[model samples]
Target: MRPSVSKPPACLLLALTSIFLNAQTTSQPVISADARTVQLERRLETISSALVAARQQVDQSLQQIHELQQELAEIKQQLPSAQTVPPNSSSSIADPLAALKTSVTDVQERQDTLEAQVKLHDQTKVESDSKYPIHLSGLVLFNAFANRGNVDNIDLPAIAISQPDGASGGSLGAGLRQTILGIEGSGPRIAGARTSANVNMDFFAGLAYANFGTSAGIVRMRTASINLDWPKDSVQAGLVGPLISPLSPTSYATVAEPGMAWAGNLWTWAPQLRYAHQFPLQEDKHVQFEFGLWDTPSSGYNTSDVLRSPSPSEQSRQPAYETRVSYGTSSVDRGLQVGLGGYYSRQHYPYNNNDSWAATVDWRVPLGARFEFSGEGYRGRSLGGLGGGVYKDVLYGTNPVTGAPAFVGLNAIGGWAQFKSHFTQSFEANAATGQDNGFADDFHSIILPSTATSLQLRARNRMIVGNLIYRPKTYLIFSPEYRRIWTWPIYGQGNTADVFTLSMGYQF
Candidate 1:
């Protein structure tokens, strides 16, 4: 005869298997404390389910034990005193009863443990002062770079500039000023819409004038918005991206300034009130219409930082107007989108009143599962405040013919396009090029003078960039980028520069 052996309950086997699998998969990066909490919650859920099954099994066993007790009583009544029953029989009944009791005790202990763990998890959650749900997200970034020619700024340079006299070589540097922090919260619904708000800040304002100022970056507000969203309509008010030109190239190396800032990317953030409505179309297609009132300051109009004064645009006592219409497929990847936009504003300068305006077109097209293309184009005048026209809004100097003060809004046309290949969920590559050209005729004879400021003379700027971004973990990123910039002045020879950068960041 084979020897008899005790077997563990099925619920216990299932629970142990789940725990072992979870442990095996959790070798991946934890990302944040919140992620660990989520893991714990899932584990507790699995264990709780097992405990429920164990409890049911115990209940069934108790029912059988009660039936067995009743059967024994009936047997005693039928067999009479002679049925003193075998000693072995009493031992067998007691042993099975003991086993069922042990199973019940085990399940109860597990349930208690699960309850304690759940309570602990609740105690560790972050709570907002107002008792609303709040989230904190940010990136800690480090960048190292090298440049091969003269440029406007060493770190995150935008345009190439003429080499100064006696300038011998390029420069190399590293910094962490691009790090960012953001806070967001959701509020109670109001006016039949969900309300939420977010604010983002970065340490990229500028360096101090003191020692080691390179590492002492000032804090700056990047963007902030309050949103009221319904099923198909939404309203937003805050410091946000320009409504006319809505897209930017992908780059981790140019966070302080967006990619291709002076060379076609018009990505200035400003205060605005926006209203948007979406119309659902056939299939997964949709159309969106956006209108906004924006506070557009004049380019290079403010000379004093310590005093509060109205900008040229503000002095006009009018806000900029912007509108855009876009068509898109609402697929998981947003398969295709195309937009057309318009902008108009008035600038009141001491010398004259000028108009700042633009007409824009933007597009995003997916080539396939792994490739995509995106771009934006615009023709505008006096758009320097919007990161256009080589960062100049107008040419200001004495008129050559009249010998009087003259101000001309610079006419400019610019655009940027990028080809992106997403090789996998964690790796990608991008190549892009852009150009912003200010009409040389707009400058007239202003640049011929030996006394004119350099900003007033630039006529065109162009750039090409290529980068590879890799994410070994969800919360970590690494990228290496190369960029070439060419800048032209209304007078004299053009300048070119080559920049190389490595960026690493951790996000949470």
Candidate 2:
């Protein structure tokens, strides 16, 4: 301003200078703000991309979890109830990691179980294990039997039909007619209970030959039944042991040795429907009650032998009933057992109606370490099927004037006792004696011919048997036995028989 010496435009000069200063300060701040906006946009873009990727990954994980759950459900359905997952399982978690962990654990458990199942199935299918669950049972036996007098066939010796004393010579035979085979099965459970079935067969089929009257044996059904096991209760239906005589003295010598007709062993097989209930009294001790309705209590007799071994088959219109109550020391039959039993039946004859009844008691005791004793006693009338009353179910006599048949019950008493000792794990010995007594007056009243063998109904029948068995293994046995049988005629001299037998068996 001094150089130009201009004092008139000082205001204009000041305004121009103010404008220039404002522009300089605003330009620097605009550049710095633009740099910060660019940086913020880059960070936002990165965050958005990460969120989208995470959503896709989570979707895939959910799909995988769903598939896994479906598989687990399928596995559960196929598995038996015994392998059911626990209700309080922690697999219901919400966290993905936790849920996945649970799924993995469940899958592993199911896999293990499935593997075990597969293993079992594989084992069962093997030739050696074809009957794994259905375990093969029973024995194969050959017997050499010799008798003092001619008797029945290879198996049982008929005391009544035996040759009268001093009338005939003795008999000897060897046979393989006592082999036993059976199949038993344990299958899938039902209603929280186990189910089982069995079919037992033996070669004791009477007097049958394969061809040309050869010794080739015929097979017979011993027992075939199904068992449903529930808690403390069971139901059985089929051909089974008689309720009145559930236990028999163990015999390897001959199948007949256990219950030879005159031996007072009231053992038989009949079709039956039975129910059993068990009540626990204390540790290792319990009580059981059983009852059954059986097939008509017929003597299974026909024309030839009907006179003496008569049963009220023609009159037995109603089923036989049996009931039993027992106390035991253990679940298995190894310990003491005591029981009482009853039987009732009715005969509906066109002209006569009768009731047959019986009361029985049985005991099995374990004496000390290696000894055992068993006994049974029964009182009844006309118990033909049970081998009592001289094997006559009901007494019959002809009405002298009416020319009609009449029947009366025959009073009877019977008992048996057995003692057994296990000399060692591989050796055993036992003795048994039994008797059946029938009222002699009833026999005398019958009108049949005096010489007719049926008229000689046994007033007293007794048997004693002693045996020793050597079992090198549980499935193999060798036995030798001696048995003496005696029968008293209703009014004449009695007859007796002596039997010697040797047996060898292998059980499967």
Candidate 3:
């Protein structure tokens, strides 16, 4: 019975068996959840490690940024402060542009100061050199001459003390007429004023083999003077010859004809004071004027007698005065020149009784490429005893009376003319004539045999002269001259003389 039950439940038993068989035929593999969870943890750990390393790099960068900020703060602290510059600031401030400008300014100021000082030094040197100056000069003259006699025979003594002889002769001679040496100089200003002076000496030697005995060796003062110049004019004082007289056409030197007479009367040196002024007149033209007072020597017989007896006292006699005015024209084409001048002079004798006055006119004419001629004429008058008087007296007798007494009267006239021939530039000719008259015939007669006699005297005198001069250069002059003089009633002796002479000279 059981077997039947165990074997059969046919539907149930078969379903169960079928299910078991199907499960076994379609089986699937399976894993634990814990193992998966462990893998997940490991991956998460790797990710965390990477994140930590990134965070570390970021922190390091931040630290480097903080250090850089500190360094920037230190750099800012080292920079200059912008505070106002202290008054006593010794430490230089940092301002490149301003410093450069200040340096440039200082350098410029120093340079200007140096330049000013140099300019001052140069001006001082120039002034000093101008204030003090020196000069030197000299002149030498040589002369040759010939003479012809034209006079009545007269007894004349010889140098050997032999008896007087009546001998007529002619002569040719040579001489060193004058040798001059000069020095001039000036001194620096004192109290804004300057001073100057000049001195010169001359040596005159007599001719040899002329039969005329003379003191051959002699030294003389040619010029000596002191000058003081002001802003407008100048003054000079010294023992000087008559400057105006020499310049006048009728003066002694100018009137002395070739063979007639020599210039300048041998007289005592006259001391004088003079003043001169110069001013511009017109374009390239000028004018100059000068005046002076001179001390006239004694005229009357006394130890101080200069020319004659009855010498006037200084206080009673009027001072000798001279004046000159000159006008110079402009230097036109080729430097031509024209001039005009006038002069006047007066003198008083020691006796106060004799007075003299003179007037002169001068002229200069130039012919272009031909020559130049200059001339002058003077008129002189003497009143009272000045007409005539004894000039000098010696122990034995008396010298020729130049300034004589006894209604003395004098009239003198002279002139000179020069010409240059076109044929020779170095060749020139000069001629001159002079005349002096006393008109004292009546006075000479009354004075009869007395040396002071003035009546019956043919006082008229004549001088004729000529010169042919050859100038090789400015410094050399070769001249052959002829001079003639005719005197009537010579010295109240009713005698006459005609003299001729020739001369040559050199200059440098």
Task: Provide the overall lDDT of each model, using Cα atoms, as 2-decimal numbers.
Answer: 0.86, 0.74, 0.47
Q: After superposition, which runs of candidate 2 have C-alpha atoms over 4 Å from their true positions?
A: 1-122, 125-132, 160-168, 209-213, 303-315, 399-405, 445-451
The digit string of per-residue lDDT tens for model 2 on 109-203 reads 76887898688766754243434365667788888888885554445565734465676567777888778888788776788778888988877
Measured against the true structure, the TM-scores of the candidates, in listed sequence, are 0.75, 0.69, 0.52
Question: Is candidate 1 or 2 superior in TM-score?
Answer: 1
Clashes of 2: 0
State each model's C-alpha RMSD to the native: 23.9, 16.1, 33.1
| Highest-lDDT candidate | 1
lDDT of 2: 0.74
Q: Which candidate is the best by TM-score?
A: 1
